[model samples]
Target: MSSAPGADAAPGSNPIPAPSATTPTTAIKRQTFSSLKVRNYRLFATGAVVSNTGTWMSRIAQDWLVLSLTGSSTAVGITTAMQFLPMLLFGLYGGVIADRYPKRKLLMLTQSTMGVLGLALAALTLTGQVQVWHVYAIAFLLGMVTVVDNPTRQSFVVEMVGPKDVRNAVSLNSANFQTARLVGPAVAGVLISAVGSGWAFLFNGLSFGAPLIGLMLMRPSELYEVERTPRGKGQLREGLRYVAGRPELIWPIVLVGFIGTFGFNFPIWLSAFAHSIYHAGASTYGMFNTAMAVGSVIGALLAARRATTRMRLLLGSAMIFGVLEMFAAISPSLWLFVGLLVVIGMFGITVNTTANSSVQLGTDPVMRGRVMSLFMMVFVGGTPLGGPLVGWVTDTFGPRIGFLSGGLVSAGSALVIAAVLVKAGGLRVRVDLRGRRVRFVEREPAGERERESVVAGVG
Candidate 1:
């Protein structure tokens, strides 16, 4: 027997519910930082702030080092590509490892390895032996570590704070990262201007101590119990099938893949703008990033306040993100471009947080590691393809053309995917000219309702 449309349904059973105008006042009033109340998560987040700041500092330093050494945007792209290539090739296996092991322990090992890599780079750069190739090697090794670290860290949040606060925790994680971003680049700029990239790398290498200590100090007893998957074959295949069957999971991943591969090539574009177009130096580059970080921090904080995620919100934000990128790409003045980047950062983080929370919340706990690995893979792994290509476009044509092309692809993909999702859900656009409103509403045909009911039941 099929339940009637609009009837109460188990969470995750209805993959696509129509948007509601009225959110409960209590949900609205929920504190944005509620997840920080958990001791374990608080520790983890505190450590993350220190480490993420170092991570961002390293990123800016690394990019500047490569550009200074090679003077070719293509070479910079190659460096970025080499770093993420591991994620493209070995990402699924990393997820398997994350599932079968204790995430906290795995994170400890990975973080330690990454710290060593950072220190090694620092050593080379400080000694004046740092070639572009040295940075490339280190970046690739760092990516290899990230293959394990990214998914493990992502799935670890649920254990720290439990399900009820997972979304809040995820939002706070973004906020933490963006907060670091707000600080990291500015500091890196001063350091690079006064000293060089070597000191920044050294700081990053040493910063890992914070996370290591935090992890060691966490009380294991307070963590939510989650069943770890046993060692087994075909787990990778099983994960692929799981996402392949779920529209909610699959669609977001697909959308991110498109956006990530094309739209998120900021390293290439930002550097080119600073070097070629703006005729500026490392400090100006850092300022551009800082401008974007300001918006990203705001966006993450806003996302933390929302108790729920919506597909419409994700799509809308993504479209706006693409449009803003396009405008920023062509701005005549440096400050105008910087201003556009702020709005771009806002919408960019909005898309990221919404998609992240939606996927994490909708997924089964046991499958989370694999699911998140796939998410991270697409979200970042595609950088290998995007980085070089965007770099080439920027090098061969100009930064404006390269950036504009990425925005075009991003916006075009969102529109196409939006149409596909609407059709799949048997939905129609409801426009009320008098109210100046538009939203998606269910189609009224009985057959369509029956079909949707059947699909919901199966899901």
Candidate 2:
């Protein structure tokens, strides 16, 4: 098997390897969907698709409902912020909890709680008792549950498929979610337009059963074993220190933090674009989301096909994603805008899956939960800050200017991070205009080169 960069390094002390090309084996090349060959993961993925579809449905419904009630993009942002606020506050603790408990059991509890919350929201909306505060309250509660759920679910992938297939599984998971994204928004748009958001919420509430049942059906013996961290103090501090010491792990998390915080406020942007800019209805909003999902699915599949993750890929994709968003923000026509959304979705998922797999592979299995929590905390948790800010921007300035500003931040941060990584790695950028290529090459001092030559001769 092709080794991931720094895959063999000690936890918290991994050396950041200089950029290198990867060559996959014939067998590895043929196993794009290799993770699905395992029955347990297959079952897990099957159930996830159903639940994720419901999730997207609920998300679209919730955003639309808030906008409909308040007629303000900022309110939709507040709603989105409420749903992710707990991650900002309590995300690290959730990871510790995941490490201390059986992931399957933890998942069951979190999933059930989320499902109930969905039902409760549905009841409020259907009975005509729903208010902005009710939606905000339920969203906050859901965020609380997700604190536990996100890490448990993330760390569980390695157990289901083992390290060999973790990257593939991660990519497939994205593909699965994007696939649902493709379906959920379309269905939600129709439901919201016809009956109201209530039924969409109800469908989401019922969707949790699929994953719960799948968890129950798994053969525990067939799953890979990972050592669970015992209950103790200092664990949270340890997780943080472990990550802080590892440049490979910490830098990617930082890059994702910037991208996630500013680059991914799609709910606010899309809703504003549909409602105010295009003067379109819920169906058009759903269509916009669905178009993006199509590109995301393609991106995920491409990631699944790769045998190795590279730092350059992550940086390049992030930069591209931001640039595309900037372009899409200014597109003059609806078709041109929708087309850009597709490409933006593609690079966006690429950034996500690459960062995810890179972090997971570099981390020790024992510390995986906490490391992933930090990864996720920066990735989604910052939404509490970004969502409201972007929402306000859209409300005050206009959707075009708001989106352009986010894109600028995302692209700019990526460039800065790339420079930092290059400097830290003691590497120089090599530009071969003749070959039309750019590469990172180690900077070898004359003394070091002479020493290496003498040593090679002696050997």
Model 1 segments more than 4 A misplaced: 1-29, 432-437, 445-459
Considering every candidate listed, which one attains the maximal lDDT? 2
Q: For every model shown, what is its TM-score relative to the native structure?
A: 0.91, 0.91
lDDT of 1 by residue, 1-459 (tens): 122211111233223222232233356535889999999889999999999999999999999899998899998899899999999999998988877778888889999999999899999999999998899999999999999999999988887887777878888899899889989998998999999999999999999999999999887767766666887889999999999987778878888999999999888999899999989999998998899899999999899888767677788788888888888888999889999998998999998998898888878777888999999999999999999999999999999999999998888888888887677766666766999855676667665442221121111
Could you report the Cα RMSD, in angstroms, for every candidate shown?
Answer: 6.8, 6.4
Q: lDDT tens string, model 2, 1-459?
A: 122212112233223222222223333543779899998899899999999999999999999999999999999999989988999999999999887777888888998998999999999999999999999999999999999999889988887787778889999999999999999999999999999999999999999999999888887666666666877789999999999887778778998999999999999999999998899999999999999999999999999988877777788899999999999999999999999999999999999999999888888877888989999999999999999999999999999999999999999998998877666666667767999866676668776542111110010
- Evaluate all candidate structures by whole-model CA lDDT and list the values in order: 0.85, 0.86
Q: Where does candidate 1 clash, by residue pair?
A: none
